[model samples]
Target: MSRSPCLLLLCLSLALPCMADEAKPGHMVYLRAVDPGIVQDIRYASAHNFTGHPLDGYQAPECLLSVDAAKALARVQTALNAEGYGLKVFDCYRPVRAVADMGRFANEPGDPLKTEFYPRVDKQDFWRLGYVARVSNHSRGNTVDLTLTGPDALPADTWTPSAHPVDCTAPYGQRWHDGALDMGTGFDCFDERAHTDSALINATAKANRQRLNGAMEKEGFSGYSAEWWHFTYSANTQKPDVMDFPITPLAP
Candidate 1:
């Protein structure tokens, strides 16, 4: 006997995996965990993106402050999107597993400086710089790692795709934000030079760093002393759990 269309639809629902609609209310959410939360409500800021990759494995609520951080990010997204640039997050609401991964990888006695994670720094120096901490604010779901991109002077709807190439050895140049200013080192630079207000950098780079810092500070977000690309909206708020969740895209 042939099955009815309604019956076939029901069968399909059971057979296929369901994608989450939005973020959960109180529970810790990650790229891996999903619940019957609301749809995508947070605005995106693409200004700080690399190679046009989606900021996967990101979870709100935990990544963002309950009220102020969320609003500031929304405004940040709006301001950037208006200029044809939006945010692309690399991580948000990191799970405990992820933090463990960083720690495990850090403790592994091997050459990681030549590796993609910390290409510029020496394997032994990473620990001294505190770039690879055993515990990360990311686990608390308040840390974010991002970069700026193009679409400069174009309408948001007509923004063109741009690539963000990260080379460890290359001299830091104007990769993004043409007129805004330079932040001494590139977004991912792990050297001590990436400090928010380092005196070792050129005057122009210092000014540029200040510009970015001011924008983030106004929104109540503070920068990580080591890495200019890192920031947390809720300076003190942090979660106990750290996890490693892969970035899975939402299906159409």
Candidate 2:
């Protein structure tokens, strides 16, 4: 029952394609590694986030983004750098586990950071108001939450819970400032003032939002109307697929 040499070679060839498919690298890339100029804050990796805990699956404080989206963001960083500004990302390529954690936390009552992050919004209303979702674009590895920062971007506060809680609807600097330019509200502020085009914000904050929006748009990123700091690289030809890979450190 010995097979002919030609038949064996054909069988090997048939298996090669399948093996190659299995060997394809994950499309995600570390943003800071791709562009050293871009800053990463990776909020979910730390306890400063609205969840008041380190979210699951954020194994490292890194910004993971699809290769194409990272390249596009690098271009945006370059454009911003020329204008005496740079991009500071708060979150990118969120793991599905982390998104699930957010959903679970939203369902539980008694939010510790509720005053700072969602004072006016009830926990149950997050899904109804489109603030929290079971699935997020970040899971697709192309969406990013970010803000503009200058060379003198303020340092992050010590982050101890304040004795007097501040409402998320308070002025940007009066509430929680993340060193980036005042974007009308802090990152993840679940309030109408955080809307991309909310007129309640001061003129300076409005101009800053427009500046970031214009820069991202120039590089083919579309801003989310409900969140001033959120944008997605829609120019990518690949269809977005949600992934659950943990944010691990990139190899040196």
lDDT of 1: 0.46
TM-score versus the correct structure, for each prediction: 0.56, 0.86
* lDDT, candidate 2, at 195: 93
Residue-level lDDT of model 2, residues 33-94, one tens digit each, is: 79978878888998877888899778889998889999999999999889999888999987
What lDDT would each prediction earn against the true structure? 0.46, 0.80
| C-alpha lDDT of residue 153 in model 1 | 22
For candidate 2, what is the TM-score? 0.86
Model 1 misplacement above 4 A: 1-68, 79-88, 109-120, 150-169, 173-182, 235-247
Model 2 worst lDDT window (10 residues) = 15-24
Candidate number of the best TM-score: 2
